[model samples]
Target: GNQSGIPYSRGFECFDERFLGKPLVYCGTLGTIPVEVGGRPSERKEIEVGDWVVMCGGRIGKDGIHGATFSSEELRTESPAQAVQIGDPLTQRKLYEFILEARDTGLFRCITDNGAGGISCSFGEMGKYSGGCECELEGAPVKYEGLQPWEVLVSEAQERMTLAVQPEQRAAFEALAKQRDVEVAFMGTFNDSGYFTVKQEGMVVASLDMNFLYEDGCPTLDMPAVWKAPTVEAPVVPETADFSEVILALLSDLNLCSREYKSRMYDGEVKGLSVVKPFVGSQADVPSDATVLRVDYKSDRGAVLAEGINPWYSDIDTYAMTTSVIDEAVRRVIAVGGDLDRIAILDNFCWPDPVESEKTPDGAFKMAQLVRSCKALYDLTTLYKTPAVSGKDSCKNDSTRGGKKISIPPTLLISAVGQMVDVNQAVTMPFKAVDDMIYVIGETKAELGASSYYRWLAEQQGAAEAIGGQVPEVNGEQALSIYRAMNGATRQELLQSATTPTKGGLALALALATVGSGKGAEVDLSAISEGAVTALFSESNSRFLVSVKPDDAAVFESLFAGLPLILIGRVNAGEVLTIHGLATLDRETMRNRFKATLQGV
Candidate 1:
């Protein structure tokens, strides 16, 4: 999903190094926007000398000071007031409407998000765009009384925007904003003196020169780094696994199990536009590969949101890791009736400190990992012809305890937004009927290094490098073709349900689908790979598990003639899932194990 590597970046690195006590983490949707309306760059109006600087929508409070001073640092804990942004969807919808009016009426020249750095950061920069800005810091609207000038300038308030308006457009803009019932503040006016001059009432409080206040205020530091590879010992073949036990074990895995406990807490269908939700199926427990949301209640068009994450794969080979995640994201989106050409990518990276220090032992190695990931992202994205619209990065994903350092792997999240011409055409990952055939699209390989099977082995054995060899590889050209073929088949209703095999491989994927759909599966694993273990459990990139109707099976096979589409299974009326020579378990047994995966303390 992260193709160009330009839209998403390390733009916030300076702030990370300067003030992050604990780096903020991103958990929401990335830069994926609808393909049809995703805009082209338009001519930007220059900041005029007399433009009015106005604040719209939400007002400021003491809650956001740390966001300016720290970038919402100490991210995990609720200790800092700026650590979280409690959203108001109604207010957000109102602001969206107001901005639409602003866009249509040509009421604003330049706009900046009043997010990370309240007015001081956005307004201050806009001030320098023309030349300078003057006065009325005190005129800024706030939620409560008695805010310091610094507080008003730095609060990390939510649902707010700063816009530059022409002198004559002020009254009309104000009236429209009032008609929308949105709060407003006419803070100041732009000037040409190269200073961001601030005032309270009639007195000058702070007058900062444009250059020193922004560009040269903080200095950069260089640090020395050293990298050393860790020693590893080859591991023996996993003790012959008990087929049913292994299947149940995977179903019970924390990573593979249902996350409904957390996801069900959100307002998924608040606007009544969710066609395919986070949870699906008759029981509403099966996880949909992509979330399909209608653009508006009136339209049949919708957008698909699918995210790919593989932190374990990152340690073995970052390039493969990056490509694999991208492949995974695109695979899921296209499998669910999304167009391949309508794809947009967003990349979010979380890595250990690249700046060498006593706290960071292998900073250089981590930096190299980060660099390799970005290059792979660019190459894969360009190859797919999808561009990343926007992205974010958090560089210091690490912790120190008892004078020892523990750092996360170089992880990249590739989130894809794809368009579907009709919401009714979207497919969910569940068996539709008893007689349909199931196919495994794309190739399977012996790429088991950093896989969940090995991770599970490591967890049970306490040996990090015990399971060695085999890093996942993707043939980009081949992957793209396969995805296109699948999308074509899905659009034609030739495929009943399509899902990718990611974390736990084909075995886990098939089992989860069987349990989710409340149908039995009889998988014949001879055609894909040689070894039973490899065929059942090896984690392969760019692969899917799709169910197809018997009558349409020929058309589907014909569509993927050149690609690796293998007939490996079928939907059945029974409640058990059976993979010949590997595993077999009933629905209730698998369901109980997978249901409480994340519920365990």
Candidate 2:
């Protein structure tokens, strides 16, 4: 171990295979610092009419030049090695410590990360609210010298922070930085000049009116959007006679399979703060709905992380797909101890370059998809009162090789974070005990337009283009009611385990719970609805499978009074999963089939 005080964490995603030839190797740095604040809303440097702009940490370098512009385009095979710079956490740690020390002294007015567009963006953002900024590029520090004026101004060097200091406190702040062995430079000044001016050697190199540059300089395009909704008949098939054959086929699909092999590469227990780690259960290898990270072990309060994405659904109805993904993410978090009131989200969009060029033939259509998806994100989040705190958009996903074009499907990743009231109240997706009653928490619908079932069926029949069904829709009001009931019931300890049917719908959810618990189930489809096919297979929105002990059934029913909930089944000790008038499948064989796709990977 390097003992660098920085933990390297990894994440695995099964969907990335749709784009890359190999598994995606992702890594991140995690750090936690105490947020020292009193009741009076934590404050930062209030940029006055006149303040000095200072840069902290490493010197500027040619490395990572045009980093922001590069990200807006597709990754080129011959990309410059200097365009992606590695981070130095140890250097960052020194700056982090010094900032805290200076922050306590109240020498700095406000501070921001020198990420992406380097100082051009950081200073511009911080000074926008004030008047504007004037930067002296000649004073900026550079690595090994010999940097052009613009290079010194826009270099996206790693591990840097920009701070605004009062004119009176500039000397004191620099002195403090020297004492802490933190490098600091005063290279710019904020003023009410209304222009972001950049000068080199006392000669103005660039000067743009702040309001125009930040606003009116960029013109909006009146884009055209053509919405062509696909039609589909959901393969009007009869109930299967032998359920095991159908169940086995569904389990073996790549999407429905287990992610244990890839997920195991991550050290979920490294900090010992995982109440419910990524994988849970008797074998400690089953997927948990949302991971609950214990924020403070001394205190019961913790945080939950959950994510949902349905790129497949985006093909037909991008707007509905966006809302459905958000709903799925929220529901998964609620399945754990997460409450709706504290839920926040991060929306990461991955789409083809929408700017029309010779290479991007249908760029306008792709751009329209991005716009619609964003509108849906705004609408759904506002409806639920859950705000999206941060987001990123990757537009350059299209690439060409040997004159052959390859592009990724329109994709959005909705990641949610919520407060867990108590770590002790955290729950998993396995049935806690035999004979516990299983309940369905929302209505099932015939929404299979972009479902994994339809995908497999289309592939099987060799008529994927001919398939179309209704995509899932979100009713924010109905979802909120269900979430409240489940979250409250979970905290009260009346529920054994809870899970929402995702990718594979109710059948897959039931199968996963059984496999994880090493238990069996007996479900009566008639209990929920008369239409067994839709009841069994439709991947509807805002539904959950909650396990309640027989003794607490009355209380559980009362907890969901007036909500759409029904007693559908019971957890059993037997090894066979039985769905009345549907399928009866063996658990072990099915579990192996589920893991087949990821075998030896």
Candidate 3:
């Protein structure tokens, strides 16, 4: 709660528990009110008989939560309840009709409906965005029936909108509103002064400097370092006969499953611009090497990608985690419909205290890894003309718990932005139909050393020592050439694509197929080499699964002549997946395993 148990008379204030050492949420403006009175007796009298009166600010207590206050206490307080009121639905509709009529008269430069915290928050934000201007509270209409000047100014009245109009347009706006039976008055003028002035009649009531009012008082924190590694059990080594089963079990693991459930919440259709909604049918959403966005009926396209390295892993292996993040982000963007050649990346770093000697060095390693990885991504993107754009960092995620301090793993969230000349040609994840050729584009190696499979499955079977190994360096030139060919190729249509990285590689690919169309796919993975199996099945970085038209195979190959684009097999017209050249399972089994693991079963 925000209320101070310690009374305000003695200069005591309630401390914000969340931001213990942070400064108080500063106060900006106090309460103020204005009203209009005048006109004829029958039709246009003072406070017109049926005219809808508009009131801006009138909230009684402190600012609302996330406003200029600390906790949720301000919203729960009972003192300001007297001033709040909601207008009748029909009356509100009539009022809006009048406002629309006034808008047709070319009266207002801008109009905004008053929401949370009434006029104070809305007006304050508007003023800040508009080069601080003075607003007169003299002619504002009130509803109190009989309220004090300050009370009238801060009452939280509903159905109010703030409008900005030039002097010459005010009369026309008023006249139009009156014609629709709505009340209108000139409350104030936009002033050049850097102060917010409130007045009653002709007397000034409250005046405050804009700078003091808008400043956020919280102090930047230098969080402490405190994290302990959890004791993990070693994984078991199954007999050769059970190897495939083990791999399948890991794929079905919930921690390695898809995130289709979470992505559906976003309203992708709001702007009527979403080409590929989050959830498709039975095919996994994972695309080839990028996710593509087609804005309109044009050929130009935009791509967005997200990637992050587990900070916990970084603590043990900084270089690997860094490389993983870069590989994953690029692959994600390219999987859908992104142009790998024109990509921009944003970096978000979350770590423990940077000032503490022990913890500072911990971050240094991750930072070094980040620099190396970023340089690699930049060089690749530059070869394709994609540049780094904007990025942000959120450090110091340390906290105290149960008498001891705990810090989150060293995590880095990286997002990539990409663009293409044509938007209509963008691809999405989901099986378009049967008989589509399934291709595994990129070189998959025997790199399961620090992979999620080894840690979660193998380690559980006393196979901890099986995880230590070096990751192979990628062939930048080959990758770049393949990307160019893909971007230049003609008649090379993509039925589906998605990135595979971190824990859910192939599983994510399958999940992506479920988005869009419900038609299931059967993929034959016998063509991929043995060494590449772990990397392909596990959530390894720098890989994509794509469905290509069989006839365009030659075009795709010619375009990616220098890259490692392996045509694995065809997407069969059925609901079963065949892998390792033998084992076969239906869509039901795949879907079941994916959902089961998520519940920790």
Candidate 4:
């Protein structure tokens, strides 16, 4: 059972921007590995026997205790608060500087941070490289008195690092530490004892066989999975004299509305390194497809980061959901003029309990959903040539309280990062000028399964749970070609603006383009044989709504050549967007509606 209320609360809440709170946020850093560091190969963990095991930096505390075990267990009202760490940035900064110096000086053969499980995890894992290790818990520095030996062993105190220093160099390492004002303690030594041994003072405290502790301590987990396809009545989009109301409602949607209130709080330009910022446009309020940050101030070398998630698609098909998000993340990177060849992805999976039990009767089905999701992730990442370099998973995410059960939809978040040779070629997701030709760069189909359009329509018809439509499917080969062409056009400086039509599809994309520039768009949908409604709102994959200057249209079209590129509209000077025979809407009105829903959220 999920002991945490987050997934359950979010699952049960209504999907309305006005009522829904902020979603959970996951943050991580992406870094590079050089060929060598300070004239030494960076393959660390070559701990030799008789090396001193040293603990450096912050003193141990009660903070972040049971962090790893707490995450593994179900969340409850009485969950331990000690699992949350209060970090000291100043101490961490000093530690980082000292470590860099020590690394360059070749003072330590192996080093690892004291994260979850503290010395128990970091020191224990590092000890595997050597035959064994013997550490004295009494030697560790602590913030407060009266902490038990076990607490000192496992407490995840922040801003500390463990290092294995050669016995001969221990004196030099201690000298540098004293000079740099960094705290260092000689805990014990790495040896060939074949056992992980711990002591308090001169008395033995704990001992375990290295083989069992490192290898055969846990049994393999095996679960049964049985997939069953789901079916539902397809949504019927009603005909209307005008789609102005529909468009406004979509702009105000929880998933699509402006989140400037939350986003504006952060300084993306920290260190004055942001090139293509998080938001772009004349007013600088429109969200960008991806953000670019210049890492090397001396040159224009930068990196791009973009993310995609759509849990609703799992209702129709988890496979499609996973692939679609992967496509979305990669394409967003491409839209921002990122290098497709250098793009890599990270996958985060949040899932319900898939273990068979009295409380989880459909555990097998949930397990099957997880299988499909992983398979799709593998297939799509391989096909796109954008490998997943790292990932994490959270299981048993269903809540149970007061005889009520709420299971969050299987969610997969795909984050893509790519290196750029130059930041000058990046493009923002807003119109650049009037009279520029607008085009749809991919085919639109009738795949609306679990789309934002249907979700909105369902609420209007008072059938919010009746999800039935062909979930959008991605064609990896076609998408790769389109992405490559997009990159070509971007590098050649042919596109004025580029953005993908996601969630509410093309209509919303057009509305945003108009709103971003405070300009009008006169679009014609006759070129699309799928009729006005499908052309306007179908949630198709591998598509882009791009604007181009007339001078670059021929070359741009030549680059796209045989792809599904079509000239569908032109940017105009007015503030009203007109779709021939469909509807006309005020750009300001759309903008206001989009921003209003989350104004104070």
Candidate 5:
């Protein structure tokens, strides 16, 4: 049984059997020296000790080694079973030499050794990777003993292979292997027909269709969602004594905690260059923020970010949910110091089947919203030189439980990719040092239609008027200017300029700060837009929490030019949070809230 969720289970085991221990010994000899090993002259010569021998074909004995002798007397008295008569090791050596020669000559696109299961497993996998091809087994070279058709099929022969060679180079390849003292055999030609055929002496022994053998039979799953609007009450002024406490409450939420535990298992250094690893100290993973990848002097670094949202709780909230996906993906890249102008988008649509007529038309409605949102993003990306690179769809996310079919919540995943001119200037989620200034760049609104806060705090079920309020459109020209200005900034410079768009607006910013520094952040939001304060604090899309140097303020302002660049607050020196104008909360309280919620407080 599998302990982990992984589909496959594998391990090693050992056991003890009660018996008297004894040394097992055996011997073997050669009937004739292989043609590649000096032929008949080598066979007539006396066998010498330390000569390595191998079974070239068939299973004639249990040990496979025919016989070996330390003296002439031992050789004369050894029985056929005791005296192991095996093939020449020189023949196997020739095969190895031939492969190297072929590689040098560029005769094969790919090749692999054939050991157990004869031609089946080795050739089967190779054929699949090669887009399917036929291999003939009759042309195989065998030792002196006549092999039965079935024996040849399952023969555990040493020094053999099911090589893939082009028609033009087959003759030269054979001559090269022969010169190296290896046997070169042509099994079959590659074909696109997608079939595997085995033959012995020009007679068919086994055949199988590639389609049936290669295709996985597992069925696609329809994971349903049973969504009920959360029943928590919204934060009233009386619910919390100070606004700073509320900010701390939001920061300590389960959704905002770092996921380093899961991320550490990944091998981010496999490719030798990981600009931004998944987990960095205290920073949380932000869906759809640009993940910058840089490691060299030249601009080869890339960025990736993703986001998913569910909006079944609101009547008219589906569109907002869709837009949120796009917004989050883009913002993620930006948070990690991505070039917004060179970004690309990938959309993943996971929803209930639209064909199912018996259920409420939530599936169709969500699908429509997704299409519209994608079209909107398409236009934006095209204007900004960002394109849609790839996408995936998972429909029919409905499951049956207790003899009842249920549909899952509306979910959408949006991914964005971008290029970074210099990874050295990349900004990451975590803060590098303390005392860096924090700022919220985008304008926030009061929209809270299908927000997690509404579901978790207010405990509301039905949609509210504020669900899809006014969405802040991206100022492309302004975004372009800011991106250009920050292109040459260093990690330290970025930390000094960090800021938060509190509520969910600065969620990405807060995550970046947390990652940059394990310690909690202290930022003032007094300079942000008061009209959209709630939205800024909440998780609205298209917002950013930027860190800028006080001295670079003029340069930053010049970069924004005509864009909406709000100087909200600066990073404090201690482990306490201060929001609005007067509210303050210590880090201990914030940490408790965050940790407790993860365990379902």
Candidate 6:
């Protein structure tokens, strides 16, 4: 229930295989909206009939032509080169600062970012606040010459914002912009004429009724959707290899290995408020489940950010995939001192087109997958009481060339943001001290379908089978209770460190914990489960690997009295990790294997 939380990038996605068409790049930023700004309610627009419509920041360009329309259409051989917008970080930064100043000074009544459709969309949207608008296309500045009026109206130039200001504040606003060296233009005026009028060189170029343009201008589309479950070959279970070899192989994998080489390139402590950074360990190379940041210098309030994505699981069960990712996100937040009551999530869907067309005859199965994914989203969010504030979807993500088609596995990335009362109580993913007790916080079953272990085994056996067993499902009620108990333990300062067993599951989780602490551990799976494979590599939901001091074991156990938990090990001073009667490996050896895959990049 934090009123002022901000979410930023938390991790990096790496790839080792080639793909068709252009590479997909994603950037997401989120922030909390204030109830009021500059003594005015933020949600209410104050645009009057005589207010001036101002365009501030960058000038017009032809680079981003069809930026909005192209995204809604399918990719083709002739996709325009001008659809991609080139960004200017320096100018954007300056504009960002200026907007803050303007906001504090009450220079504008309403503001919106000039993204997507540029002026045509921004001005049109703002016109709804008032009755209509009259735009003068001739007044807009351009980067170059020979730009048509229509192009100027729709050009998706970067680093720009649209504002609504009173006529009396024009001089003051212009003076401030000049002082700040930001471009400002008076391109239009709000009116009550019920029509959007565009003029160039004192001649009317376009005029349309606001009602028709906003409501009835576009025709309704009817798409056919039929649901049929897809069938995939069940993979044969290969012989279980030695635990040490399987652990090392999983650590050396492209998707499971270290990403510190690339993560170090970004500035994680830009504001000097990052309490728990992206990488936290004795060596500062191990990835953290979630990052904790101090909200500001004046308060001890903290915000937590974490993300979860498992596109491979969509091949088996998209509903379970959706549930698992949401659980992962919430578990990561809890791992770093966040509570279930304050967590909120965001969903991003990247799927192939699901229409019954000539190019896609098997579109019904994909449609069914999407529907099941959405149904899971609805059920889990409600059950967890984590509301989704905003989300986006891209439907056409397939490419076809020479009668061969390639479609991305359906992906749904879930991001969670939550707040905690104190930043000092936050924890990292590592063993804090030697002789600390280790425990698994939830039940692990034989659910390894589309898991990293199965994928690694498939590659080892030279088999193309990447799916098997059962896709893990989430129990929202049980998870919520475990998270609450974890929060309670965190408040009492009874836990040393915590992390979830994701991707590579319990084995990788333990190896990473050892790598982060620069210490070894003695673990025994006999008390947790009888089968070593299920106990070590099953990708079960709502599970955590937590370390506790031996002195606090009684109190910790009392707090988690009814939860599914078991004390299975203890941290040690030796340099080798010993899983009693199973296997043992040197700490440095395991670290090298984890860092080998992405060492240079």
Find the candidate with the highest TM-score and give its number. Answer: 6
lDDT of 4 at 534: 78
Model 5 misplaced regions, further than 4 Å: 1-242, 269-272, 281-291, 294-319, 359-367, 430-436, 460-503, 507-523, 531-536, 595-601
Which 10-residue span in candidate 3 carries the lowest summed lDDT?
A: 1-10
Ranking by lDDT: 6, 4, 2, 1, 3, 5
For all predictions, the C-alpha RMSD in Å is 5.8, 3.6, 12.5, 4.7, 17.8, 3.0
**TM-score of every model versus the real structure:** 0.87, 0.88, 0.59, 0.92, 0.57, 0.95
Clashes of each: 2, 3, 64, 3, 57, 0
lDDT of 6 by residue, 520-600 (tens): 899998776777877888899999999999999999999989999999899988788888766687888989999989988
* Model 5 clashes, total count: 57
lDDT tens per residue, model 3, 1-601: 0121111100111211333222222211111112321221222211111112233222222222222121222122232434335444444555666665555554555556665555555455455544454444556665524555554445445556666666666567667766765555555554545666666777877776767677753466554433443244334433343434544676565455545444333344443444534444444433223434454445355444434444334534544565566556665555555666667666565544444455345644434544544555465545545455655444454554444445544455555666665555656556566667777677666555555655555546566445444343445556565555555542245434433444545544654453333545555554555543453445444565667677766666666665667775666556665554444545555566555553432
Q: Give a tens-digit lDDT track for model 1, residues 1-601.
A: 0221211111111111212335445554433222322142334446899999988888788776765434412234445755345556567668868877776677877778787767888888888789888868778888889988878887877888888988999999999999999888888888888998888888888889898877898788665533344334434566577878977887777667777666654567655777888777768877888888887778999888888877777667788889889988888798788999999889988777787555565667787777778889999999998798888777766654444555666768888889999999899887778978988988899988877777677767777556556768889889888888888897788878888898788988888778778789898998989887778778888898999889988888999988888898789999998898777899878877878856533
Give the top-scoring candidate (lDDT): 6
lDDT of each: 0.77, 0.79, 0.49, 0.83, 0.47, 0.84
Q: Which regions of candidate 4 are displaced past 4 Å?
A: 1-24, 43-45, 168-182
Residues 1-601 of candidate 5 have per-residue lDDT tens digits of 0121111101111111100011112111111112432223322322121111111222222222222221111112223342333444454555555655665665554555554445565566566654455544555555546656544555445455655666566667656755665545556655555666666667767777777678853466453333332343333313333455445556554455433344444444443445655544343433213334443335465444433333332234444555555555565566666666666776666554544255644544545544555565565566556666766554555544445555544455555666666665666554444555555555455655444444334432342222333333445555455445444343234334333232245533463455345555665554554533453345544555666656766665665566556665555556655555545556555545544444432
TM-score of candidate 5 versus the correct structure, residues matched by position: 0.57
Error of 2 at 487 (Å): 2.6
lDDT of residue 414 for candidate 1:
83
Model 3, which residues run further than 4 Å from truth?
A: 1-244, 261-271, 282-313, 316-323, 340-345, 357-391, 417-424, 430-436, 462-477, 494-502, 506-535, 538-540, 573-575, 581-583, 597-601
> Better model by TM-score, 1 or 4?
4
